[model samples]
Target: MTGWLLAAVALAVGFWSYGWQGGVLALSVIVFWLLLQFSRAMRAMRRASESPVGRLRNAVMFQSRLKRGMTMLQIVGQTRSLGQRRPELGDDVWTWTDDGGVGVTLHFERGQLARWTLDRPADGPAEAPVDAPPAPAAPPPAA
Candidate 1:
């Protein structure tokens, strides 16, 4: 809706500047770009809303599998401390364990650990148990 209005405005301006043919072509390209961007933004917003829960569940499931395999361990907890900056679209924290080792970290914009990285665990003993913290509260909207 907003996209259409903006596109209409652009078309009107383009027509005024370069006549119908140029305006139509320019407007078509601009509209196409705007629609693509809008869809991507919508998907990102949805995914960000759901990610903390999804990460917690995945981490818990992985921990359970590890315990089943004679690896005495617990899910303990998970946390998603907000990074200093927002992550790019489709990025979030993830945790997993395998025969090689257990690991957890953020999956972010350009690469993993865009914010911080926890030290890798060794076989000796688990570090201080840290349960996952509650998700951060959403900020209030501006008036």
Candidate 2:
């Protein structure tokens, strides 16, 4: 991966510039950076675990905050919970639902968000069933 390549480059540069001591310094720095990243990820996961599965405070707000190419970790951090994986749909499909029964389905490709859709329960007064016939129009009043 890119991270590995960068680390390798850093090691090579360090050794080329100042011998073994520089290489040791570069390795230490790299390890420290990796540890920081790991710690950050663990913190996010811990926070997320405090919430219910697939449940967020406001799905609409979450959807609004979403941008293309966001990683799964970023989305999890925003939602404060890990999404429900929908492997039946695809390998990378995940869904998060709110208390209102609204759901946001996300599709990721190559570990990045590709697209997402929000599913909201229908609101307002109920309408006639599909099988019901249309009601006749009322006659107009005489002029």
Candidate 3:
């Protein structure tokens, strides 16, 4: 790929300018960069694991902060938790829901955010789920 080609070119340049010593220096720099990237990912995952999966505190605020082309690690870092996978739609589809019944669905391609949508609760008061216990009946008015 292009990255490999650029690395090769850098190695060649380093060797051409200062022989083996330059090559070693260039390789060390490249390794350090890779290590830094790996460390960043580990940090993000650690932050994400502290919270419950697929849950958000403020879905609306998260939506507002979203930007196209964000990496999955970046999204995880922002949300502070892993999204719930939706593999039925596609391999990279995921969603997060808030306590208010709002949700956000996101689609990622090549590990970068391709598109996303915010799903809000429908108009009208919230209703309990079908399996929820029925409300108690009110007592008759006193005479």
Cand. 3 TM to true fold? 0.80
Sort by lDDT, best first: 2, 3, 1
Cand. 2 Cα-lDDT: 0.93
The superposed Cα distance between candidate 1 and the true structure at residue 12, in angstroms, equals 15
User: Compared to the true structure, candidate 1 yields what TM-score?
Assistant: 0.31
Each candidate's lDDT (Cα)?
0.47, 0.93, 0.91
Backbone clashes for every candidate come to 2, 0, 0
Candidate 2 residues 1-143, lDDT tens each?
89989999999999999999999999999999899989989988999999988899989999999999999889988998999999999999999999888899999999999999999888835768999999999999999
Please give, for residues 1-143, the per-residue lDDT of candidate 3 as tens digits. 56678778888999999999999988987888779989999999998889999998999999999999898888898898999999998989999999988899999998889999999888859778999999999999999
Which of the two candidates, 1 or 3, achieves a greater lDDT against the reference? 3
What TM-score, computed on C-alpha atoms, does each candidate reach? 0.31, 0.83, 0.80
Model 3 score (lDDT): 0.91
Clash-forming residue pairs, model 1: 77-132, 78-132
Instruction: Give the lDDT of residue 67 in candidate 1.
Output: 25
TM-score of structure candidate 2:
0.83
Superior candidate under lDDT, 1 versus 2: 2
